[model samples]
Target: MTEPVPAASAPSGGCPAHADVLPLYGPRFLRNPSELYREMRQEHGPVVPVLLEGDVPAWFVIGYREVHHVLSHPEVFARDCRRWNQWDDIPPDWPLRPFVGYQPSTLFAEGDEHRRRAGAISNGLFAVDQFDLRLRSERIADDLIDAFAGRGEAELMAEYAHPLPLLALAGIFGMPEEETPGLLRDMMTTVNGDEGALDAYQGICATMERLVAHRREQPGPDFVTRMLNDPANLTEEELIADLVLVMTAAQQPMAYWIGNTIRLMLTDDRFSLNLAGGRRSVGHALNEVLWEDTPTQNYLGRWAARPVLLGGQQIDAGDLLVLGLAAANGDPRVRPASDTPALGNQAMMSFSYGEHRCTYPAPELAEVICQAAVEVLLDRLPDLLLAVDPEDLEWSPSVWMRGLVGLPVGFTPV
Candidate 1:
C-alpha cells in the first residue's frame, strides 16, 4: 500500500478554541480522509468546523453519538435549507451550489411536508416487486459481463459497476433504453463537479421533468407512476423533484457500493477466503463495506433550529450542521476493538437514522446488485486479478460520497 498522506493541518492550531475551518473538497482531504477524521475527533471533540467548496463554514458532527443525537432530534435540528442563515452569504458561482442549494425534495423538506414527500417515496418503493427487481438486476449483470468476458481484461467500475445500476433503474423508472446513457452521463458529470456541471444538472432535471410529463400521459407500473398516483398528492413540481431524488439516490450510491464491495472481496484475504469457502455470503462482504467504507460518507445537513450547545460546541440558530456518517461508523467509541463479523449488525450509519432516514431500499438493493454482478464476473473469469496495484486505485474526489474512479482487472482470455 502507498504511504498514507499526512493529515492537513487545521487552519488554526490543533486546539478547538483555535479550531480551523478545514477544507472538505481538496485533493489532500480526499486522499486521506480517515487520517483527517481521526485528527478532527481528537482535537475538536464531535462538532468540528469545516469549509465546504466555497470556503463556507459549517459544523461537522464526527462522533457516533453526536451524529445520532443530531439526526434523531429533528425538532432541534431541521433539514430545511430555508433555516440556514448563511444561505445568502454563499456565492452563486460556488462549485458546491448544485448540492448545497435549496431544492423542494424530501431530502430538504421538514415537518408535515417531509412526511408527505417521504411517504410518496416509501409507497413507490414498497410497490416494487423484489422478485422482478432481482431478476432484472441479474439480467443486467449477465449482459454486462458478456460484453467484456472474451476481452479477458476490463475496467470494472466503468464496464460493470457504473452501468448496472443505471440500466436497472431505467427499467424501474420505465425510461426508454436509448435515453439511459445520456441521463447517466449528465448525472455523473453533475455529481463529479466537472466543467459545465450546472448545465449537466439542468439537463438531468429537464429530462426528469419530461419523463414525469410522459408518465402522466402514459402511466405504467413504474416508480414514477406509482409516486404520481400516491395519495400524498404531490404537485407537478414536487413530482419532478421527487423523481430527481429517486434517480440520484438510487444510481450513484448503488454503483459506488457495488464497486467498493467488489474491491473488498478481491483485496481482503479473509473476506475472499470466507466467500470462496462458503463460510460467508456476499451480504457479509457488503455489510463490512458499509461499515468501513460507506458510499455516502457525509450527509444529513441539518440547520440548528435555535442556539444550543452540541458536542461541547456552541452554535447559533441558523448555523448548519452535517452528520459524518462515515466517521461515526469507524468511531472507536461504538466500534469493537477486534475485527468482529458485521453480518447481522445493521447499526451502521451509512443510512442516517430517525425521521429523515433514507427511504430508498438502498442496502437490500445494493446487496442484490453486487451479489449478482460479482458472481457473474468471477464465474466467467475465475483468474481475474487487479491490473494495477490496489494502492493505485483512484477514488472520486467527492466530499459527500466515497467511490472509486475505476477498477482495472486482467485475466486469461476465455
Candidate 2:
C-alpha cells in the first residue's frame, strides 16, 4: 500500500498549477469522452488535475492500476465526504451536491460500520433466488416487448431498457404493482439528475420509508424484509437510507447496462451476427459494455486522508479524487486498443473495485437481470435494427453516467 504524505509537513514540490487544470464538463467531454481520456492520459499521465462544474479542483485518477489502488486502500483515500476541503465554496444549489453530500447510506460509511451495513445488504441480495430472479426478469422483458412488438418500430431506451429493471426492482422491493409507475418516474428523474432531481430524490425516500414501515408491520419474502430481519438490526432510518441507495443503484446503471449492450448488438457485426442464435454472444456483449462504455464513467469519489503521492502527483489532504472507471478500463497498459475487441476480458473497473464495489451477489444479480433482458429482447425481435444512423445516437449529458438518450430501432412486426 502507498502511504499518504503528511499535510504540507514535507517540502512541497508542486504538481500542476490550479490554472492549468482541465475542465471535466462542456461540449468537448460530452461529444467523445474516449478521445478526451486518451488526450488526458498522454498530457497528464495517469492522474489529471481537473475542474468540475464550478471550476472546483480535483484529481481525476485515469490509470487502471491507480484506480485499483485508490479503491483498495480506503485508508489513504477515504469515502466520507465530510472530509472534503472545498465544501465552503460549494453553493447551496450545486447540482452535484446530491451525489457528494453526506448521507446516512452505506455509500459514505467507513471502517467496521461500512462492513456491517454493506454486509447486511449483501445478505439481503443473497437471499434472492437466482432461478426466480431470472424467471421474473424474463417475464418483465417479455411483457415490455409485448407492448411494442406489434409496432415494428420503437425506441428501446424509453420503451424497453429503462422500464425492465425498475419493474423487476418493484417486484424485489415488494412494491404494489399499481405504484411501480410512479416509482419508475421518480427514479428516472433522480438518477438522471434532472431539474426536479432533488424532489424526485425526496419522493423516492418517502416511498422507501413507507415500504420499510409496511414491511415492519408485515414482513415478506423480499429484499427489504430480509434487510430488516438481518442480525445487523438496522434502524428504520438506516434501512430507509440504504433502501434508497439500493433502488437508485439498481435502476439507472442497470438500465444503461441493458441499453448499452443492446446498442452494441445492433451496431457491432460480431454480436449482431449471433444475436438470434446463441446466448454466449449476449454474455460477450454484456462484458464488452462494462469495459468500453460502462454506465458509470466517472465517480465523484474518495477524499484524501492526508497529503498523498499518487501517480507521481501530490494530493493534498481533503482534496477530492474522481475515480475514472471508463478511462481506467481504456488504459493501454492493461487493455487492448479501444477499437480492438476485448473478448473474454472481465477485469474492467465498470462496477468499480474493492470494499466499496457493488457487493457480492448484487453484481451477480445484476448480470442475471441484464442477460435475461438482452436475450429475451433478441428472442422477441430477431430482426431488430437501428432506426437511425449510428452517429445520431445522443448520450445523456451527465459526466458521471454513460447512456444513450434514446435508441430507436425497427423490426418486423409480430
Per-residue alpha-carbon lDDT of model 1 for 1-414, expressed as tens digits? 444323234433222222346666678656767777877788778888776665667788999999999988999998888887776666776766677678888888888889899988888887777788788888898888888888889999999998999998888788878778899898888778788888888888998988888898999999889988999999988988878877877788888988998888788886666544442466677788888888989874888899889998988888888789999988888885626767788999998898888786655665676677766666667777889888999999887889999999888887
- Candidate 1 segments whose C-alpha is farther than 4 A from its true place: 1-19, 274-279, 336-338, 360-362
Candidates in order, TM-scores: namely: 0.93, 0.94
Candidate 2, residue 201: the lDDT equals 82
Question: What's the true lDDT of residue 97 in model 2?
Answer: 79
lDDT of each: 0.80, 0.87
- Candidate 2 residue 6 Cα shift, in angstroms, is 33
**lDDT of each residue in 1-414, candidate 2, tens digit only:** 322211111112322344467777776656778778888888789999887776667789999999999999999999999999888777876778778989998999999999999999999998889999999999999999999899999999999888899888888889878767788899877767788878888888989988888888988999999999999989888899999998888889999999999999999899888877878999989999998889989998999999989998989999899999999999998875677777887789988999999888888889999999999999988999999998899999888899999999999999
